[model samples]
Target chain A: MTRDDLDVDPDELYGRLKAYEGRTAASGGTGRDPVNEPMIRHWCEAMGDTNPAYPAVAPPTMLQAWTMGGLAGHPGGSARSEAYDELLALLDDVGCTSVVATDCEQEYPRPLRPGDRVTFDAVIESVSPRKTTRLGTGYFVTTRMNVRAGDGELVGTHRFRILKYAPARPKNAPKPEPAPKPGLTADPARRPRPVINRDNAGFWEGVARHQLLIQRCLDCATPRFPWLPGCGACGSLRWEAFEASGTGTVFSYVVMHHPPFPAFDPPYAVALIELAEGVRMVSGITGVPYDKVRIGMPVELEFLRVDEELELPVFRGAEA
Target chain B: MTARTGDELPPLRIPITRTLIVAGALASRDYQDVHHDAEAAREKGSPDIFMNILTTNGLVGRYITDHFGPRARLRKVAIRLGAPNYPGDEMVLTGQITSVAEGTAEVAVIGKNGIGHHVTGTVTVQLPSDAPGTTDASRTDAPGAIDAPRTDAPRTATTPDTPR
Candidate 1:
């Protein structure tokens, strides 16, 4: 439909958007554990980084995980607010349906650590109506979230682009082809297994037994993976282990054109997979076409036996 | 200590003030009271308004553009934030040349707020290394040709009331 065909009131839209901001402000905080340390370690390891500063001082992109506290606890405070949900409801009240996150840009003033309580206040930054798409026509709302500490220090800011669609298209798109099943055959010869470094030896050991284990900080109870010396939260040297479901969604992915190491295959799909436990792991995707990979697609972990002594953990599309 | 080739860039020092901080906050649509309101910030434990990372990035980009000129294109930027850049804090942006290609230069950039290297990252930019040439004058009109008045053609209307 043309812009003229839609008779939406600008004042009504502003009121609804204002109410959304009010609700989000009242949410107080998500209170969730930000950033999983072991996951960060695993990612760093996969990238072949030896920088001491990452685990010691976490990065801003990794800080998004720390906002999970509101989702973990009871339905009070931030959990009750459901800022995005309320915004979506308001959009519905204004005669719109179907919303999807399109893009996001975030900035950090300080690296987030464990024990630091964070509260997020988001506002509907702007909204612009767009022409029809494959999914039909609607408005694109850009919401900006400002994260702060318990004492009100600015931690970071995130800008999320959400597309509010008109109610003509299907809610769920058709599923893609399933990934090939893991091969059960074992290679007879034994190859020298890659040595796990001081940081990630525990994780490799857990993988040997077909168990997906995550690292947890003993001090603040924050769970992480790709093990490291000290906890990301309290900076304590002590940590423990917790198992994870070998399932996740592809947060992001890239195909390698160059092999950094002898063991890694060229043109392999490397993806940032968000686990069922709310942690994200950087792993390779196997048994699927590289072009078919999409963010938020369901994937399951598969252990590929490279040799008798080594089994590499990879992922494949989940079967229906 | 001497700076190494691949070492982090030396930090640049910029005075933190409401003007810079507010310009940055508004540019990024980050209207958080802590970033602009001094009294509210004081109530929240912050000494003064702090600059958002986006603004820092923009300023860094501007600095690079100023040094390189307008034709230079920014390819990529990856920055990591470190400390709070409070008002009156010395903001420093440091960088080092990481790699140089035929037409591109990659530099690792970092920003410091005095306490330490508050932010660290990298940027790649494309520059015009060669000078412009005047080889093809026939294909297009030469510069100042169209606007130049004809010497022998006509001189008219020195005064509005007099006819040529």
Candidate 2:
């Protein structure tokens, strides 16, 4: 809507963004709380993680958690340098207003423990020249934050990226592409294998035997699916395996229609099935149209063995 | 291993499943219903629950580190999303080293899924400076080292709607 007013010079804008690189984006920011239990608990609960090492230690994946400004940033904590704002305004002026995060790379040199005071400073790492994406054309801006503890030990480095782009002209609700005809889009010759290794080999071994197994914690009896070596709930390496009943309720489901992978047909339904044993695992839903798959739908497991090498557990709608 | 500027890093195939999609989102503390709820996503104009950009970003980082090994650390990774990776789609990641100087290598990377390219960007990594007994042959034969380090030109996409 706003591009009509300006005769934009693409190179000048690119030059402006490049100039903002390596500037101080923010500094002297402190986490509102010490790396503590409440936030850790919230993260684990939402993640369905039962790893035993949490609370005492944060998940390495939470490297950027402490630096988040949240929905309403704190009064003084929203202090970004003027150059950062000007660069964003320059992008905004050129109609690259819609922003979406692209990627992040975090390196943790030390594990953050509870009560470790979190303080961080960030620098405008780098800004890219004009790049186009399916979402729209935009510039990629990156920021690198070095997080340290109150004790002054380096905790981690978080490099975050975002693409500020103009929204693409809406395709105006195009018709869902029809599944390819058999001769047009032939099925893949073979199903791909899961990344199987020492850590989760036992789970696949159980699948090979046609037994749906849940890893049960020896200390807490908590049943977890997609097996883990140690229990997250109580932090115990001691665990036993139990056979699942293969009956489940569709906790939630989606009908996939795009970016058609060779191994799958479009418009197929995938469901998060809550097993009768009280754990959830994801699998394809069968015996019904993708649209008809509903939340709370009862389904039973059916292991579809594709070709000689691959066998996967899918769910079929169960009779009333 | 000595790398030329155009030397293609081996591609990494990642299966896009409901679980992988959801797990990657949750791991990043992204609780947007659009990521986990299909009905919610449909209301917001998506055909299905799509993988979030954060997950796509994390995967891009994983691909870079996996190729260069532990000695190399990512100094920066910039990416843009293209096609939405839905359940049952597989993403194939490919990259080529564009420049190398002073133990720093710039790589151009893209991840293509069943439909089209899911992401494209550049990753700059700090390779181990102490590469023992480095020779002129070990220096990448590709263009764009620090001396002539210019930003990558915009890439043209094969698909009309694919991200470049």
Candidate 3:
């Protein structure tokens, strides 16, 4: 969409921005949205993170969500604005027909939790024209969202790149080179056989019994991994292991092109699965084509004997 | 007058600096020049490269873990960054016990730059309050409770056609 097609008024955007700024300042340095337990749980579940470091402690990403103002009665109306729809309307006015989310990167200093009030200040970082492929010429607009708590403490920041194209392309241009893989890997021979760390011994033991186990601190009753000697809550030294249904959905995933380890084959699918018990875990996807892995797809847990003493948990498509 | 019965826990303090900023950046975040590059940050209208929220959160976590000792598992910690923390700014993190229930204590946390409050949040931690072995093992069964072995049946071991 061209600038001319956008019906949005600069004055209105400024007004909203200023109003948001004022509200945050008024909140006594608290986030417009309060971090709570449910939100933390949702984020942890989405990431499939069982690290006790997370639920045991508030996960870092959880802070990101908390700093993000709520849907209504919050700090910035930008997020509340039907951002895509508004862009579309502006594009339609400018005579552009399509837009796409090209890239986004978010950075955090720490995680957010309940009681911290945060505010977000956003600006159009840049807007530049781009060459067209199958789609018409387009412009990429980057917006930077700066977040801080009510007292003006820096929280985190996010950059979102939105590409507005005219008439839209039927398909994206193919890249000359493949995308890079994510996560760490090691050689099969050199790879440290995934050992059951002190924090996760109960989990491995459960796997030996063909039962999926999760760690819960007896103190706060939070479930997470890398079991600590004491509960994260109240520092209680009590913990409990419980069984899981071993069923979940792939919340997010990636296929590795470069093998980081010898034990791992190229083009393996790694996923964050949200299990039935309201927790998420990172594991490999097997028994299906890598392309079949998609967010929100049903999966069930299975075990792989990585070595004589270790068993690695993997997932596959569950029977409908 | 009813007698006050409990002892107030000592407040916790944590220092925030450029080192924390680098650690947060190394973790793969893309906020921008203001977080690490001071010169670029000045051009972007910031007094200095301000601390990223992610690092702030990490620091808060570090503060609690440091005080509780490594064995003390952090159950939950939440913080909201209030002001822009420049490289030289010293952040004082403080926490006070709010309540104790079922062997757990909740602490209200706040971080100040000496000028004003920079962050405020809460943390719930599990202390060594319960009797040994009295902990429930069933609590660990939540999905994603801990790392587990993969469930997919292993693919047939076929030699790759391409020699390594």
Pairs that clash in candidate 2: A50-A232, A50-A233, A51-A232, A52-A232, A52-A235, B5-B142
- lDDT at A266 for candidate 3? 45
Each candidate's DockQ: 0.01, 0.06, 0.02
What is the lDDT ranking, best to worst? 2, 1, 3
Error of 1 at B69 (Å): 27
Q: Once superposed on the true structure, which residue ranges of model 2 sit more than 4 Å away at CA?
A: A1-7, A45-50, A75-77, A170-320, B1-49, B53-83, B86-164
DockQ result, candidate 3: 0.02
lDDT score for residue A156 of model 1: 76
User: Model 1, A140-212: lDDT tens per residue?
Assistant: 6776677787588888776666557654423242332221111223323253566679788878888888888
Error of 1 at A35 (Å): 5.0
In the range A1-320, model 3's lDDT, one tens digit per residue, is: 22232334545543433332212111222344465555555544332233455444355444445543333434433343344335445545554555444433455554555666676656565555443433245556666666686467666666655556554322232221211112223223433655558777777778888788877777688876444567655777787888878889998998874313444544468898888877788888878777678888899888977777677778987533
RMSD of each: 26.3, 25.4, 26.3
Tell me which of candidates 2 and 3 scores higher on TM-score.
2
Q: Which structure is stronger by TM-score: 1 or 2? A: 2
**Model 3 misplacement above 4 A:** A1-320, B1-13, B28-31, B71-75, B128-164
Local distance difference test values of all predictions, in order: 0.56, 0.70, 0.53
In terms of TM-score, how similar is model 2 to the real structure? 0.45
Q: Give lDDT tens digits, candidate 2, residues A64-154.
A: 6676565456457565667788888998888776666666666667778888888888899999878765456788899988899977788
The lDDT, on a scale of 0 to 1, for candidate 1 is: 0.56
